[model samples]
Target: MAAPNTSTSDLYRQWAATYDTDGNILQAVDDLQLANLLPSFVQNLRSSRPDGRLRVLDLGCGTGRNTKRLLLAPSSMPLEVTGIDTSEAMLAVALEKFPEATYHCLDPFSRSSPLPNDLRDSFDGLISTLVLEHLPSDVYFSTLVSLLVPGGRALVTNMHPDMGSRTGAGFKLGGDGVRVRGVSFAHGVQETIKAAQNAGLEILEAAREVEVDEEMIQRWKGKGLERTAQRAQKWIGVKVWYGVTVRKIGDRED
Candidate 1:
């Protein structure tokens, strides 16, 4: 029998222990994709705010995976960054790595609860990486809409549905590890765009799909991630992830 899937909370709680060290190839690929978009996002965000301070949100900022790089990226505007997550355990790890940033938790069980007033439509930019595949399309984009200022830009990356349909946002357990996936919803690129549009956001840039290739396989092998290298072999020439740059499209009640 296939191992039972772990609950989202349980999966992240346990996964947090080794999340960063696990040599996750998806994160490596995602980091590059998001990194390419950061300069534009930072520059555009700062231009919109006169004080030259960039208020950025790392929505689903897991284990500071992308946050560390964002904090380190060269930016003329000083950044005021905050992170939100559904797992306290994961948040604890993030805090340990990035004590300078503020962190908040939204009850995963009560996702409908609104964020604090100060957070509503408050950010100049947002980054959500490798997270959307695990969420229902509406919930994911709606949450992004809530966190951005009108006209704010966000860079969102996710496991391509082609890939998510095979595997999802999950990791193998600590030992003889059983792979555990959270609730993964298949979301095609058009479906994602449609959901965002419905949530009052518009795609500023079309989806950029990334495929696995031989260089990635060799890179993983060089990193001592033999298992990851082996896995990528099966995915070569496959679209593994996609990203889109978007902006909040309409006026929203803050």
Candidate 2:
């Protein structure tokens, strides 16, 4: 599949209209995994600051899918969320869906781009789903550290580099019927871990998921794309996406 050579922001702007309805199985899997892991991380944050509300930043919060999930998730303490994305079209849709949450339109990966002063080192937890692949490894790790308070936790999910190499570093129809493709970078698992360590983050958990089960196979089958479903079945045990949970341990150098 030929991927788009456009900038990430332009790609998402074009994709914004159909993103939510795109039936992306990788996104579906990531959401399920993150949902399972977030409560424990949230509980940890609440335990540390019993009197204060937990504040979260949703990086690359396209259409606020993960942002809404974080906001609606059941938690012991009060929660406030802020979302940031580079595409105005994407943010427009997100703002409409989540009017209460703060939204910013900025490129987090830009070296000159700085987060609002009030938000620096202020978040209790941060969640980024299916977004890191578009960012440089160094920028991704450094930005993650800068956005969190000391010992603040972050949950990040991305396409596994191994899988991305096989599938290429961009989007495809995948039986989802969406034609949009974005530019992406493939950062290996060790490369990400080393970047986080260099940024003074302690890795707490790392996991990879591969799904080619009957239900998943059936879903692809339903899309009427026999070739896509066959490919999925062929890569049954191969890692699809990877998730990591890390905590900031010291000051950010960048």
Candidate 3:
């Protein structure tokens, strides 16, 4: 996971206030393989624990964009959901939108602080979407397994590193003063699989899919940021979103 840079937090803070109304966030909901991603993850969780209430963790839950959607999804259960993020401004928006669930503003990657001990192994499953790309290699995979119960499951999606090869550049912050050096490193299937194995988690489902935000690309193009626009086009051309579902093992509680 990436270190929490105050700069990044502030930028995200400002973005949080209107993120949901912006073209980018709105596009992600309709663009990302969300139509399928949401339903599938919901069904999987229900299948595994059909009879009980559910505990869920929404990692990097920016302004509750994904959290709001999940909570409102008709397929989801009555959940005791917790959302964690590095941006308080974003968490503020989330808390307002989802008063029913809990929200925490913290850097999951700092390693200085781990998840609350009492909550360890307490969740039935976890869901993190479009948040992994910001994490450095070390924190990205390690923080994931640490948050789950032994038999717990996680669904995560990140910007595919393949974006670099396809468009000459991967994800980057523009006008947003976020310090993310070494943040663009992309994890392939093998690395992700290895990370899960090392963490004693087993892969249940995984794949890369296309996620294109046409309005965002056009917005960049209109702004004459040809480079970013071209890359965005390449992003649409190629499937650059990767996702995976893994279950923690080796803990007998399951």
Best by TM-score: 1
Model 2 residue 49 lDDT?
A: 71
Clashing pairs for predicted structure model 3, backbone only: 1-136, 1-139, 1-140, 2-135, 2-136
Model 2: pairs clashing at backbone N, Cα or C within 3 Å: none
What is the per-residue lDDT of model 1 for residues 115-182, given as tens digits with 9 covering 90 to 100? 77898878878998877887788888888888788888898888888888888777777634677777
Candidate order by TM-score, decreasing, is: 1, 2, 3
Q: Which stretches of candidate 2 lie over 4 Å from their true place?
A: 1-4, 168-180, 218-235, 251-254
- RMSD, model 1, all Cα superposed? 2.3
Report, for all candidates in order, the number of backbone clashes.
0, 0, 5
Q: How well is each residue in 136-198 modelled by candidate 3, as lDDT tens digits?
A: 555776787777777788887766666523321112244344423323446665676777677
Most accurate candidate by lDDT? 1
- Give Cα distance to truth, residue 21, candidate 1, Å: 1.7
Residue 215, candidate 3: how far off, in angstroms? 13
Taking all chains together, each candidate's TM-score versus the true structure is 0.91, 0.85, 0.76
Give candidate 1 misplaced runs (Cα > 4 Å).
108-112, 223-225, 250-254
CA lDDT, every model vs. true structure: 0.80, 0.77, 0.66
